[model samples]
Each structure stands twice: as C-alpha cells, then as structure tokens.
Target: MAKTNAEKQKLYRENLLKNKSKYDQMRKISRIRDNKRKKVERINNKQSSSYKSHQSFGKTVKRVLQSLPKDIHKCVSVVHHIAQEFNIIPKTTSHHQREQHSLSIELKQLVMNFYSQDDISYHLREAHQLFLIEHDHTDAYLSLGSFSDLRPS
Candidate 1:
C-alpha cells in the first residue's frame, strides 16, 4: 500500500532537500563560468578599444594617402587643402578613387560620348574634383628656340 498523504509530503520534502544541494552546487559553477566569461569580454573590449584609438594618428593618414590612385595627386592635394582650411582630417578617399579606377575604358568613353556641351560643364565640375584636367583642342603656338617648351609637339 502507498504511504498516507502526510507521510508522502514528508518524503517529498526530504527528496527536495537532497536535490537542493546539487542544485546549489550547479548554480555556483554556472555563476563562476558566467563571471569568467564577463571578465574575458571586458578584457577583449578594452584591448580592442585601445588598439583602435592608437591607430588614429599620423601613420594612419600616411597609409590612406599611399593607397589612393597616383593620378589623383591633384585631387588629393586639393582635398588636403580643404582639410587644412577646415581643420578636418579626411579619412575616406579610397572609395571614390576605387570607383573611378574600376570604370571600364569603354564605359568612360561612353559617358563622354553621351555628354552634351552643358553636360560637359557639369561633368567637368565633378570630374575636376577627382583631379581630371580639361584642355582646349588648339595646338600651342611656341618658338622653336633651343630648349624652349621642351614638350613634344
């Protein structure tokens, strides 16, 4: 026969106490693991932040300038002037330079072909910002004197 109701209650309480000790032990282990995980995260966060902040100095600027297209020297110079004027350091010329460099020669010629005279002016306005220069079609009239305007005709 099964135990009476009051006896069953006592037995259940004893069993619960026995399991409670194991539960407490497991809880302690879980808390220690959680604390160790938090400590590692805090350390990682501190190290990453320190490294990031340390990388924002002059070497970073030089590295950025080095990676830009050689053709955009003029544009970079202009950007540098603007940065100097505003006391702001420009950090992202690579995207614009990369976009221009990746355009196919056919695409560039197509763009030029499609432009109207008015559009040429608009295009040049933006293009000059990226160091492209515009010149007239007329040949330069110059003296043939020795060493005069050494550029080939």
Candidate 2:
C-alpha cells in the first residue's frame, strides 16, 4: 500500500510539471484582458477633456467662416477678435492677409520645433531669438511660446 501511494504522488508531480506551460498561457491571457480594460478606461478619461478637435488655426478659422451666412459681419467680427487675440495681428484686408500671416507663422513654428535642447546651446538660442525679433516674427515666436510656455533661451 505504501509503494502504491508513493507511485501515485510521483505521477501527480509529473502531471503538474507537464501542465506548467498551460498555466503560463492562462496567466498571459488574463494579463492581456486586464491591460485591455485599463487602456479603455484611459481612453475614456482622455475623451472627457476639452481638446476634442485636432486642427490647425487656419482650418479652425475656415470652419468658423463657413458655418456663418456669407452676408453677416457680426460673425466675421467674432472671428477677427479671435484672430487678433491669437496675435495674428489682424488688419484691414485681413480676410486675405490673415491666411498669409497665419501660414507664415505656422511654417516658422515648424522650424522652431525642429530645434531641441539637446542640439541647441544658450548662445545659438539667443541668436535665433534675436533674428526672429528682427524679422518681425516676435508675435509668431510669442504665439509659439503660448503653445508650450516656452521662453527665450
């Protein structure tokens, strides 16, 4: 009877060892399920923020203009106010000029973002700021600053 019990215990241990990979697979599946649930929760939280749209200033302006009747000045005035507030520096003939200025500012902004702290030094950054100031891009630079809270280095 003792010999039979010992043989049975040995067989049980072997069976558990043989099924170890199956146990690992189940653990992996469970972890994947939990991670997927957490990811969904994170996405839901992000969707609750005010940043619902991803668009350029030019596109946003175009959208606002299109939404209003073509003959109205009040809505245009509101758009102009938004443009001025953003420091696009609205002027007479702004319907044409605003697009050009905004495009130019956006281009300069792309160039600025190309420079990073790792590649640029103090002196070069100062020179770049001075150049922008001379080129009448101080407003554009400030607008960029407003986006990321960046300051002259």
Candidate 3:
C-alpha cells in the first residue's frame, strides 16, 4: 500500500536534498574545468595572434628581397647587352664598378618605368618595415622604458 501524503512529502524532501548536493558538486567541478580551459585557450590565442601580421609581412619581404638579386642580375644582363651593342666598356671600370653603375642606372630607369615615384617608395617603405618586424628587430621596445616613451609622437 502507498504511504500517507505526509510520508510522501518527507521522502520527496530527502531525495531533493540528496540530488541538490550532487548537482552542486557537479556544478563546481564544471566551473573549475571551464575556467581552466578558457585560461589555456586565451594564452594560446594571444601567442598566435600577436606575431601573425609581423610574420606574414616578414615572409613577403623576404620573398621579395630574395627575388631582388635575380632581378638585379637580369638588369645587369640587359645593361651588358646594351653596352655590347654600343661598344662602350671603359678600361678603368672594374667588373664591380660596372655592376654598381649599371644597377644605379637601371634603378633610376626602373623608377621612371613605374607609374609614379610615390607608388614605388610607398611599397618599398612597407616592404622594409615588414622585413624589420619579421626579423624581430623592431626598436619600438627599446622606446618602451626610455625618454621617448614620455614624448608624444
């Protein structure tokens, strides 16, 4: 036979308290794990994000710089071709001097070949900054504890 209504209430209260204690323990454990996981994720996220742009820029600059020597060689070949056609080799000009002079002339001509000087300079400046940052050589950290820190840029 079923218990009286008063007895059922007492049983219900006892079960509720037991389950409540278990639930509270579970909640505490879940909170601790969640906080730990979040802390670890936050640290990893910061490490990955901080150097991403710097790394990207650094890679691009390195690639561009690497190809530069090849481009310079090509330019030198072109200058040699032109000089040979005109028979204009100087007796005093060493091979190094010839290369240097040709490079200077080629650079000037190439700058003119561009649509504008500002465009080339802008790209060069950005590439240079990326190269610097990528090398982990940004001097801004030096300014952090220096007098420059106090001055407004």
Candidate 4:
C-alpha cells in the first residue's frame, strides 16, 4: 500500500531539513556564476560595437580626405598613398638642399602641373600630417614636409 498525504508531508519535511544548511550556499554560487557570465557578455558586446565604429570611422576619414577637389596632382589610392608613394621609394627624393631635401623634378611637375598655388599649398598643408605619419625615409619626409619652400624653378 502507498503512503498517504500525512506520510508524504513528513518525508518532505525531513528531506528539506536535512539539506537546508547547504541550500543557501548552492544558491549563492549559482548566482555568482550567472553574474560572471552576464558581465562577460556585456564586455564582449561593448568591445565589438566600439571596434566596428573605429574601423568604419577610419575608412570614412580616408574616403573624405582622398576625394577632395584638386587632389588631381598625384594618384591618390588612399589617405596615406602620397606618403607611401614618396617615402617608401628610395630615388624619389633626388637631393638635399641647405636644410631640407627636394623632390625629383618629375614628381614636382606631376603635382605642379595640375593645381594653382593656393590650392596646392592648401592640399600640402592638409596632407602634411599623413606624410609625417606614414613616411619611412628621412629624405622623403624632409622633402615632403618642406615642399612649399620649393620655388617654380
């Protein structure tokens, strides 16, 4: 014969009392683990979101800078294309002046042929920072940095 309601209630009370002391500890550990999991998820979400924005922001800046008017002097592949073009190549900077190096005549003509004085100067000033950042050779860096000093000779 199966036990009736009274016996079932009596058994349930005994089991609850027997494990009561450990119940709170188990609950606390479960809660802590859940909290850690939630924290990690939050951090991952934040990192992914910020990383996406940073990559897109960099591309946007490059596109805007490269597509500006009167950028017709040199072939602009990207934001730092001008810097890499002159800096990485060894023979680009032909010689040194008193304090600064000079770009090859061909290179000078390439840009000088297309732009007016004011526009060319404006482009150089704006692109100067990129050259400084991307240039490898000291001569190319010097030549590009001091381009405005070059006369029409």
Candidate 5:
C-alpha cells in the first residue's frame, strides 16, 4: 500500500508538469497574435492618414483653380508647379526668395488687371496679415512694435 501511494504521487506530478507546459505555449502564441494585430492596426492608421492629407490637398488645388479667370485658367498648371516648389524650398534660401518674388509679381499683375490700385493694396495687406497669423508669427510681428503702424484699419 505504501509503494502504490508513492507511484500515484509521482504520476500526479508528471501530469501537472505536462499541463503547465501546454499553458505556457498557449500564452506565448496569444501574445504573438496580439502583437501582430497591433502592428496591422498601426499600418492601417498611417495609410488612412496619408490618404486624407492627399484628398485635402487635391480639394485645395481645385478651389484655387476654380477661383481664377477663364482667360487665365490655363495657368493652373503653373500655379500647381509653384505650389509644389514652395513646399520643397526652405523659406530662408535664395531659391525660395526667387519663387516668392515670382509669385508676388504674378499675383500683382493678375490683381491689377481686374482691380484698382487701392483694392490691390488692401488685398495684399490682408494677405500678409493672414500669412503671419497662419504661420503663428503674429506675436513676433507684434513684438517689433511697428505692426500697428503697418497694419490696415
């Protein structure tokens, strides 16, 4: 009876070890599956973000093109090209300066063709203020203490 009890104890210990190993393997597989799911979700999120950005950009271009005069409609391609160049060029570079100069000349000429000098000046001032605000540089402009004098009423 003593020997039989000892054998039964040993069999129980072996069964416990086998069950523990299976549980560990299942846990490892679950962790791997969870990691794979998270990775896929991250990739999908990035793709959706990229798609939305591109869609918004296309809408902006379309709006700009539609706002132009019929005679100047052909210049839409040029405007798009300029926009692409501006995105790539840093504000502090000479190439960026040249692009800015060209853009300003083109805008002035376009405005002058359909509007008075006063109107042109008003629009240009408004555009400059909007740019400062959009770029979060209004505080810097105000700190110079000369913005009030330059700003239009």
Candidate 6:
C-alpha cells in the first residue's frame, strides 16, 4: 500500500532532526579537540630548556671582554680614563693630546658599535670608578657610588 502525503512529511521531519543533532555533536567534538591541542602546545613550550636560558646584556659584554687581547683591554682602559676625566674636569683638553683624543673617540665608537648602549654605559661607569680610585679622588668615588645606586638593575 502507498503511504499518504501527511505520513511522508512526518518521516522527513524526523530524519531532518536526527541529522541536525549529529551535526551538533560533531561540532562539539571538534571544539574539544582544538582546546586540548592548545593546552598541550603551551605545556611543551614551558618545558623547553632554550626558552629559560636567556643571557643579559651585561653578561654578554663581560664574556666578550674576557676573550679580547690584552692590548685592546689596555686601550679600552685608557679611553675610559680619558672619558671620565673629560666629564669631571671641564678644562682638561691639555691633558688629552690630539692623537690620544682621536684614539679615545675611536675606541668609544668601537665599543658602542660592538655592544648595546646599556652595556657600554655600564662599563664606562666601572672604568670611572677605577680611575677615581687610582687618582686618589675619594670624594668623587663616594659620590659616584651613591649615584650608581639610583640606576635600575
């Protein structure tokens, strides 16, 4: 016997509801899988050793300085001394001869280009402290120590 039009319409509605529920379930499963994958990726990143081993600018500068030849080290020391004296004494041009001044300027540029600005500044401050100690400028050395305390770590 052939089915009536009303009965055929009812069956079609039931099948459509079933397909809609299946689609909803598939979508929910896909969302859960995506969330799990993201969590795993985050955990892996946290566990990687390379992610934790970062070097600071100052440490890098120290390492590079340690490997340099003694001549270059002495040159840097001379430049540092001249620079410190230049800052402290306004009329110290006579102390630094033309050749010495040019050498100091060249060394300053080389240091600035080789390392970061912060690293060069830190080294310069250290050199200033040494210079003050060598010249028996106790008062200036003490003041510099206090000033350095205000700088960020």
Candidate 4 residue 133 Cα shift, in angstroms, is: 53
lDDT of 3 by residue, 1-153 (tens): 989999998887677668988767767898999999999998886753434588787888688557544677786776676677777864334456432212244433433444143443433435333333543533332222232222223
Output the lDDT of residue 37, model 4.
99
Order the numbered candidates by TM-score, best leading.
1, 5, 4, 3, 2, 6
RMSD (Å) per prediction: 18.2, 24.4, 29.2, 21.5, 21.3, 25.2
- Angstrom error at residue 81, model 6: 25
Worst 10 residues of 5 by lDDT: 137-146
Q: How close is candidate 1 to the true structure, as a TM-score?
A: 0.24
Model 2 spans with C-alpha error above 4 angstroms: 1-25, 33-48, 51-71, 86-153
Error of 2 at 55 (Å): 21
- TM-score between model 3 and native: 0.22
TM-score of 2: 0.22
Instruction: Kindly list the per-residue Cα lDDT of model 1 for residues 1-153, writing each as its tens digit.
Output: 889999998887677668988767767898999999999998886753333555575678788678766777776887777786786975554645433324444534434443434444432335332212242231332222311222123
Candidate 2 lDDT by residue in tens digits, 71-109 = 668777777777788889755643454333333556455
Query: Model 4 TM-score?
Result: 0.23
What is the per-residue lDDT of model 6 for residues 1-153, given as tens digits with 9 covering 90 to 100?
999999998887677668988767767898999999999999886744443446655577688767655797786766667667778535354655564212244433433343344444654557445434444523322345443443335
Please report the TM-score between candidate 5 and the true structure: 0.24
From the highest lDDT down, the ranking of the candidates is 2, 4, 6, 5, 1, 3
Better of 1 and 2 by lDDT: 2
lDDT against the true structure, each candidate? 0.54, 0.61, 0.54, 0.59, 0.55, 0.57
